[model samples]
Target: MVGCPLTWQRVSINETIAPEDVAFIIPGKTTLAEIVARLGAPDEITSPDGRITYTPFGLRMITRTPQVITASYPGAVARYRFLDFKRFRANFTWGLKFIQPVPGIPDDFVFESGGIGTDEFLVVLDSNWIVRQHAFAKHADASRYRPWPFDLEPPDDNQVVSF
Candidate 1:
């Protein structure tokens, strides 16, 4: 029996900065004002040693994990976090109804398959507020809505599971 219909969904938080947009940044040379003009104001600015404090807040559901870094005097950081999900299933139990979900009634619904992909970009500034260092991580296929949520590529020999 066809359990239920399947729907694909996507959700993203904040605009993901493109690689090209930041390519022009030259560490030790790019000034803070130039960086801001090129990429707009950073989401968050902070000084580890009492000079950094800023972050963007929205779409509380999306999760982002960032490493704690303590920068030098009067530094700053720019952070961008984005995530996308796909394939949503609605489980419902029907004793009489066919489509409409009945409240208070537990349904035999299983979200068979879904996927989540996330990306983050971080820019760190030095005491001079110049481009001290930066890093960016993204999934090559973060946008592709593959039917299967799990990894389909050939298994990695190094990534072995233990009992």
Candidate 2:
């Protein structure tokens, strides 16, 4: 028999979201203003890499009565029934600069990352608060890869003082 192309199946693929990553669960009715009033401004705002999201879910209930109870006027035994439903969720990203910054970076040096899908979005804006350029993923095949300026050097202030 002729050899067949190898097939790989991805099983148990899971998406890991950061604990602090803000995800909007309610759309439209909720706005950025409400978020700001409740949770202050984001640490950083990334133009061209912006994102706004919204989601909504609903709950419903149902009741049933037995036919035997219907015959008996006001006072009769009634059977209660209940049914639960799975929660629904919606997600959407509005057009705007990706506003927010993830801390834990050393102040002396800054960290940048490749555009979307290259691990968590950690884009760095220029001094003028404009997006300069997006970094590319180191590994194309994988979902995530390292970005630019991975290594950094500490500033040198070693100069002899004149007496």
Candidate 3:
């Protein structure tokens, strides 16, 4: 039954922005103006304290107001959490045949495997809008053997999983 149609199905997911592009954004060097220019406007912007969040596809960036000051990349600081299985299953597949070797999927379905994970980029600015500190947080549900009938237990929270 393995690799059989009944046991597997094709799935596809599109990222609004590429992970490499996000990596290009330097913590102490990248500026808000440059981010807007490179990535365009964010999905949401919050004022008062000046918090800007961009949600492009699956990537999330939370930063303070624009500033010329050098920003800091605190590295991964937050505790990792497992993503929801339902969402992960919806976006993932279990076979190499389902994957297409190309820059982008032309078809409606974007064949992908593994659970949906959250990668967060955080930036904190000083009162003058200078980048003070920053951090990246990521969490993904563990990939497991899921039968076609979907009879697999959800990821256990007790386990310390990493991707």
Candidate 4:
């Protein structure tokens, strides 16, 4: 099925389909009319430099499994105690226990910045749209963003250095 409920029966029976393919992918360089045909009217329209942008709400489904557990016993338990009043007391017990579906840390977390799908993608743009001066950032180095206040000069010209 192309989709879950409304099975878009165009290409194949069970083959999965990308959401972008159904929503955005056109045969070739598509125009406004083709866009309206494939995807319905846009939520917001913008025209800048004679280029039109049709921004629509992206579809997504969030799923999560709440932590839980299930346990069972093989048989019942019976305890019996006896005191002889001379040496020792005797006790007996029997039972079985089992636990299933242990919970653990989540495999994937969605909170981190620069996440895969969280970033915006610039679609349908010419070569001139390529960025020349991109904002570069050093991820882990704090000094890259903030220079040291003191003048920490490099070693003298001919000074010997040891590791």
Most lDDT-accurate candidate: 1
Off by over 4 Å in 1: 1-4, 48-74, 88-111, 139-163
Q: Least lDDT summed over 10 consecutive residues: which range in candidate 3?
A: 74-83
| Winning model by TM-score | 1
Clashing pairs in 1: 44-54, 45-53, 46-52, 46-53, 47-51, 47-52, 91-109, 93-107
Candidate 4 wrongly placed segments (more than 4 Å): 1-28, 49-163
lDDT of 1 by residue, 1-163 (tens): 3444555566666577888978988889887789778777765565645444334332334347664756656666666666666555544343324655767755564444655667767777777778888888776374555554456688777987789
Better of 2 and 3 by TM-score: 3
- lDDT string, candidate 4, 1-163, tens digits: 2112211111111122234534543323444444446544333222223232222222212346552323332221111111111111111111111232335633222211111111121233223322212111212221121122334687689978799
Q: lDDT of each prediction vs. the true structure? A: 0.64, 0.29, 0.41, 0.26
TM-score of 4: 0.19
lDDT of 3 by residue, 50-146 (tens): 3333344334444666644233433212111223332222223334346755445442333324444444444444334334454555443432324
